[model samples]
Target: MGDRRLAIEAWESLFRAQHEVFGKLSGDFVGSDLSQAEYDVLLTVTRAPDMTARLRDVTANMLISQPSVSRLVDRMVGRGLVTKCSDPDDGRGALVTATEEGAHAFRVIGAAHGRSIAEHMACFDDEELRTLLTLTEKLRGYRSGE
Candidate 1:
């Protein structure tokens, strides 16, 4: 019973911390060409080889639902930030590639966003940061069956 209560407390703390941090960090996107979700999609797309990724792969990396991701990708396409093409290997699957403009915007926003993250995380020492990363990844991996 004590262990279960401790677990619940820990989970609540984690949830509240994430919500606070994300809410604060989301301000970095204001006035940028991309919203937080759009930037997230571009992050995966831009990091892939040839600046392209499978749409499903992008969806997998995102926090949003697959349908929401598809809609977001459509809006991004309309904005000329990305281009969509049918995957050659899998005809039913679509691929998303960052346009030159998209890459440029990502780079510009990425530099500032990196600074924002660093500022927010500066409270943690290197060891603490490492431990945090390891624990979070462990939690995620458990859910992902890794």
Candidate 2:
């Protein structure tokens, strides 16, 4: 086994780095129509086929509780950012589809956010970035294949 002290130190470093980076990126939503949570929801929705995704899937990808995700979706519906409906294939499931306005907002903020992420991540070279990606994925219990 690896040194326990070294493992804890590494984990602390990773946590601090993530906290600092997220704090910086949180500014991307300032004065915007979408909050960080909304953007996160749309991020998954917009990438899904037909700009739609399962509510469960969205919730799975989020850091918040399932009930919180439901409430957020309700609020988004009220704002006309997205439409939520029961999934015909599964009575217990719901589907969310982005409205045109939501898609437009996502695109706008997504562009700027992308640039900001690139700028922040530019400190790492291509090789280092790849290594970081692999290490993070491994730490998350993600493997190349099931």
Highest TM-score: give the candidate number: 2
TM per candidate: 0.94, 0.97
Write the residue-wise lDDT of candidate 2 on 31-62 in tens digits.
Answer: 99899999999999999999999999999999
Q: Count the backbone clashes (under 3 Å) in each candidate.
A: 0, 0
Q: What lDDT would each prediction earn against the true structure? A: 0.94, 0.96
**Whole-model alpha-carbon lDDT for candidate 2:** 0.96
Query: For candidate 1, lDDT tens digit of each residue in 104-145?
Result: 999999999999999999999999999999899997785365
> What value does the lDDT take at residue 72 in candidate 2?
98
For each of the candidates, the C-alpha root-mean-square deviation to the true structure, in angstroms, is 2.1, 1.1
Q: What TM-score number comes out for model 1? A: 0.94
Please report how far candidate 2 places residue 73 from its true position, in Å: 0.6
How much RMSD separates candidate 2 from the native structure?
1.1
Show where candidate 2 strays beyond 4 Å.
none
